[model samples]
Target chain A: MGTALKEKQEKDLQHEDLLHRYRNFSARRVLFIILGVLILFVLAAFSLTLGPADVTIAEAVNTLLGMPPSGTVDRIIWNIRVPRVLTAIVAGAGLAVTGAAMQSILRNPLGSPYTLGISQSAAFGAAFAVIILGAGTTQSTASDAVIFNNPYIISISAFIFSLITTGIILLFVRYKNASPATMLLTGVALGSLFTAGYTAMQYFASDVQLASIVFWTFGDVARASLWPEVVIMTLAVLLAFAYFFYKSWDYEVMDSGDESAKSLGVDVNRLRLHGMLLSSLVTALIISFVGIIGFVGLVVPHIVRRIIGGNERYLIPSSCIVGAILLLASDTVARTIISPIVLPVGILTSFLGAPLFIFLVIKGRDFW
Target chain B: MKLEIAGMDFAYDRKLVLKNVNLKVKEGEFLTIIGPNASGKTTLLKCINNILKPKKGTIKVDGNDINHIGMDGVARKIGYVPQMSNRAFPTTVFDTVLMGRRPHGNWKPSDSDYRLVSEYMEKLDLQDIALREIGELSGGQRQKVMIARALVQEPDILLLDEPTSSLDLKHQLEVMEMVDKQTENGLTVVMTMHDLNLALRFSEKIIMLRQGKIFAYGGAEVLDPVNIEKVFGVKVSMAHGSCGPVIVPESCVI
Candidate 1:
């Protein structure tokens, strides 16, 4: 009778333990999600407040809320600063989420937009548009002369090339049964090849064309107008995010290796191809608009993994929000740190992202 | 469900791995295949799950040719576990097990799926470490988690390739015992094992392979001392123990 009572008590304890765990897990996830959304709002507000013509946080809020604004502040807040800030936030979130998805799919921490040669290929394509297509030159007259002044054409070219590069890499890796190390090496080689082509274009470019190419590569959110480019990029990012979120479970399974995922009823090849395409599409859209922002893709996913573990359900969304905040903060610093002279946000990201990545590496060395 | 393979011939490029192999597994039977290294044990297991298509011959599960069924449909009927454990990403134990329900439902796990996963975790005594990262677990714990994941699939057929290769002796017996118990539930289990004695002790039937062809297929009675010596190229003596007959390799006397 004593043994039966002991067993009953143990069963009750186990039941309570499970209940506690389920409640705690759900609660913690909810808390993080709320925190993430709140951080995005705060960062958005901060971004709106910074720029060449500084508006006070209060005025910016009133302008955003469609209240009466004082003097030139309305134009500065509405026309220029708002679009730039929104561009930074959207592009940052999209790129970081893409990076996270890529890393999870490839099962490599180093996998990213730039590391996988997608961004570099896009940059090369843009450079090709500028040089070969003469899109950078300002034309004055002559009906027969080709005019490549539109940024959309260049962006489309970049997107196409980036997709092609990713497809080629996937085909080669699948055929060769290449190890992750070899995949990374191949990506690096492809990146270098594209970079070389871009450099050659730069060498042949005129002074004005060179300046334009350099600025594009340095990444500027300022070029984002309220045009079709913004609309298209926004739509593309949203679609990519939706697709990735839907496949988050598959991505999580994939991190366990291909064989395991296959046995668990995941079509490993289809999952991988879909993930790569989504990631490449997101990366291409961001790079086309903002040019080559280097380290956000490499660093943000690692940070998100450390914070919430590598479950894609949490990782994808968390990385998106944290990435938006980090880039917004970096952009704000870039604009305000030197007052009138704004440094490129990409440069600032590298300066900040590198140290943060190193810190995470040191802290999470045991897990790695 | 019964699995039948008829005149199966498979090869990588021109080098044949399995040639004209025929086998049948009844429902609720524990079948183990034992062979020397490079005897195509892993390859045969891969073919059963349609991971590698047989160059010649057909495989059927429950009278339906596997090729006629879609890959996902075939996967739903069979659960496979490979020999190696190399998870590059640090996913948690619960999520790993939850993945087995992939073929059963949509992308998001339903409540029933979670319940099934929890049941398996508890059965495997893995509830304590369900929240932990898979990488942090010991070899035995990791193997248990993999087995738990496969169990969550609720597959009619479970195929394992050297499932106990990395496990310690105790964990090996623990795993085999679990597999043995599952047989009573009318689930067919096919496994490739490296340990001859364990295979003999636990499996209801054993298939011995040499050069990708079946050398022998029968109960422990057919696995005589002469046959063991011939297949493994090692001298062994059989003794009747308390539980059953034990094959002790002569080299172990030292």
Candidate 2:
């Protein structure tokens, strides 16, 4: 009896310790999210002042805080930098949240808008607009920017083709009863087909058309105008984010497996369909305006997952913050790396994201 | 919950998986389904949990048809732990177990949900590794996590598929004893297992299935050499062990 009492006391103490540690882990996740938001704020401020206009961080912040536009500095801060940074933040958050959702719904760590061919389809659509419909032309300006004949046509066509690819994949999932792995493979196959179409379009293009198509393929957040494009993306991204956040528990249950998720009262097929449609819609919207910013969707969620584990309540929000930070920082570097000759932020993200992803895979094999 | 299945049939495409299965389990009864490979033990459990829709059947819980209860209603009554697989993500053990409260609550878990999860984690001896990733645990630890997840659901009926398949002797005994205690509290347990001895020790009622059909169903005496040979195609003799009676496989009946 004495031994039993002693054993019970020991077990109670152990339980207390376990509870403390669990709380600490939860606290740590919250801390990471807080820190991420702070970093995003600081980075956004720094990014606003780092362009060719020589505006200081204070000046940019002042302009953002309702300072009257008195000179070139205020105009550049309000017009160019604000729209670009806001676009990056919204677009980045959308890609990351959708990436996290895609991974959960598909039960594949490699699942993302980019990996599932939404970006490629968008690219194909843009190519069709530029090469076939003559929607873009190369303006022989000092900046060598490709001016769209009707930018809305390019964006609309890109959006349409992306939906078409998503439609084909959903059809396969519905009729063929395709598994997540099978769906990914289908995405890869369709991605290749679309790439072939894009290449064929390029082969038959005029020099100006080819230049315009190539330039449009280079994803740049600065391409978005503030009036409708940025406003539309912001609303779409926030709506999708809210939906994903609300369905956070369901996504966490889905990580267990489809059969297990069903047993837990999740309608696995419906969630998958909804998740894919919303994620693809948001991806198409972002890509249509800013072109194919590849790696934010794929890599940011993974980095956040490694830190916070696979709990979607924390993972989704953390991925959003980290996604915003990564894209914003990449955009800043793309514009400032060789001043007056801004590289495409999409090219820079892939350049940075590829190596970082490889390193994470090598170093954290147990993360998945 | 009292469960009744009548005229149950399940098929994958044209290939039949379960054929005209019928069963009635009383509330708080400890039932074990024993069978060979492809014997539909797992399928029957899935059907009961409403994870798979049967081609033709009516499953009732407390005389109410499960089909009419809706998925969430069924999940509130039945908790399932599937067979352990290699597919795992980096979810913490505590968070994984807390997911069992999904049907009971809304989006966020309530405080009582956390309390229940903590209680089950302590009972399962998983509190020590509560913060560890599920993927990082050994097979036995992962199995315990799975069991704890199911137990935290607070369901009237618990379904387990090969719960002890990966556990060692000590863990096997511990899990069985824990589950046996739950049965005393009026939790109905329906488990499919390959281990005949463990089933005999803990199961008050035994179901022997062979090729998608019930070969035998009764008390411990029903698991005799004749029934075992017919269902499992193995010749076995019941012998006394230090703890209880054990089935010693003598030779292959084929």
Candidate 3:
């Protein structure tokens, strides 16, 4: 009877432990997502006020909501600042989430939409359109968000060509069941191959075309101010993000390695295929609008993983938030730092991201 | 559950690894596979777990072909702990073990699974470092974590490939003894190991493989010095120790 009493008490303690663990796990992740969403919104609101025209944050918010901000503030807020900032948030969020998925599927920390040369190939296609086929030039710009002069044709070509790179990579992965190193090497090799083709095309381009091509490759988020393109990017990113959430649990297990995941009954090849397809789709969507925005996809996920340990459930959403904040804040600085000069958003990300990436490698040397 | 393998064949790059391997494992039996480097022990285990599909054969669990069953169903019945886990990321020990519950269709780890996993973690003495990174743990600790993970699956059959390869002698005996105790409840145990003495002491049955075929299969009587020398090209003697027949490897012939 004494033993029976002890067993019953032990059962009660075990039950309590289970409930406590579940509560602790879920509460932390929920708080993280809530905080991320909050930060992204605040960053988006403030970024809208940062430009040569000098609209204050409150004025920008008021103008956004159809209130009074004096004359033509609504037009500038509606036409210019709102779309640009929104695009930056969308692009940044998309790239980072895709980065998280890429890293998991490839089992490599450095995996990203850009790492697999999707962005480089997209740059080649967009450059091809600008230089060879005679596209947009920034010589006659009144408003600074002005790189997307030939929007329709350029966007389509970039989207199509990015998918082409994704297809090649997928085909390669299917054949050898490629390792992470192989994927990285193949991607880098593919990038060089496309770079060679793009360089040859540049030689035939005239001086005006060459200037436009240079602007496009530097990742101008300004190009996305065309409302229809912004609408497409925003809609697509959100939808793809939803899909990633559904696949997050599978990704968490896959991080252990393919054999372990298979032992756990996960169809590893299918999961990787889904991850690659969705990530590339998100990459194609963003790269089409903004030319090769490097490092956000590669960098933001690493930072998020370091902060909160690598559970894909929290990792995916937190990465999106951190990425959105990073891009929106950087794009704002890029616009206002030199006043009317307006450095490309891509240039700003590399300047910030490269040094930070190097520091992380040095500090957390054996992170993987 | 009863496991039967009939005419199982496997090849990698046109070189056959396992050929016509036939075996039957009854419920609650401890079976240890002993073989040299190129023998088909690992391939046979992989076939049973459905990691690699044999060229032509059937692995039936209680008379149902493993191919007919979904991989999840196969995973539900058999918990596999492979040799030398290549884990790079530092996930928590609890998270590592909790993945075993994934195949059982419980998304949040049902109360029972949590209870069972906790029990196994405690039994394995892994509760102290349950929240620590798997990568941070010593090899013996990680091996225990792997055992806890496999145990948490609550599988009818537990398949291990060199489960004690990294463990020291003390932990090795502890794990094998624990597995031995669990088999009293009709849990099927199949594992491959290099230590024939442990197999002689702990396992109910042993299967010896040479090249791509089963050379011998039976009780400890099959591990005679002649058979050991023929299979492994090593000279060894079996002595009647206090525990059981202990295999003493004298020297390698090759």
Q: Which residue runs of candidate 1 sit more than 4 Å off their true CA positions?
A: A1-16, A70-74, A137-150, A170-185, A225-227, A364-366, B251-254
lDDT of 3 by residue, A1-368 (tens): 99999998986676567547755866776787798898788878878777767788899888877894786788888988888988898899998888888888778877887678788788788877776566665464644534546766777777888888888888877887877677778888887787887788778777767766666778888877778988998888888788878766667778877777777888888888778888888888898888888889988888776656777877888988888888887798898888777888888887877777678667652446
Clashing pairs in 3: none
- List runs of model 3 lying over 4 Å from the truth: A7-26, A54-56, A62-71, A137-148, A354-366, B106-112
Clashes of 1: 0
Candidate number achieving the greatest lDDT relative to the actual structure: 2
**Candidate number with greatest TM-score:** 2
Per-residue C-alpha lDDT of model 1 across residues A165-266, encoded as one tens digit per residue: 887778766787655566667778888899999899889898767766776678766656454556676787788778888988877777888777766667
The candidate that wins on DockQ is 2
Of the candidates numbered 2 and 3, which has the greater DockQ value?
2
The residue pairs in collision within model 1 are none
Q: After superposition, how far is residue A188 of candidate 1 from its true place, in Å?
A: 2.4
**Candidate 2 local lDDT, A1-368, one digit each (tens):** 99999998887777677777878989999999999999999999998888766787778888888783467877887788888999989888989999888888778888987678888899999999987777887475655366777777899999999999899999888888888988898888888889999999999999988888888889988888475788999999999889999999988888888877777788888888888889988988999999988888888888877667778999989989988988888888898887787888998887777777678777753564
lDDT of each: 0.81, 0.86, 0.81
Predicted chain A of candidate 3: TM-score:
0.89
* Model 1: DockQ score: 0.56
The regions of model 2 sitting more than 4 angstroms off are A1-16, A69-72, A355-368, B86-88
Q: Candidate 3, overall lDDT?
A: 0.81
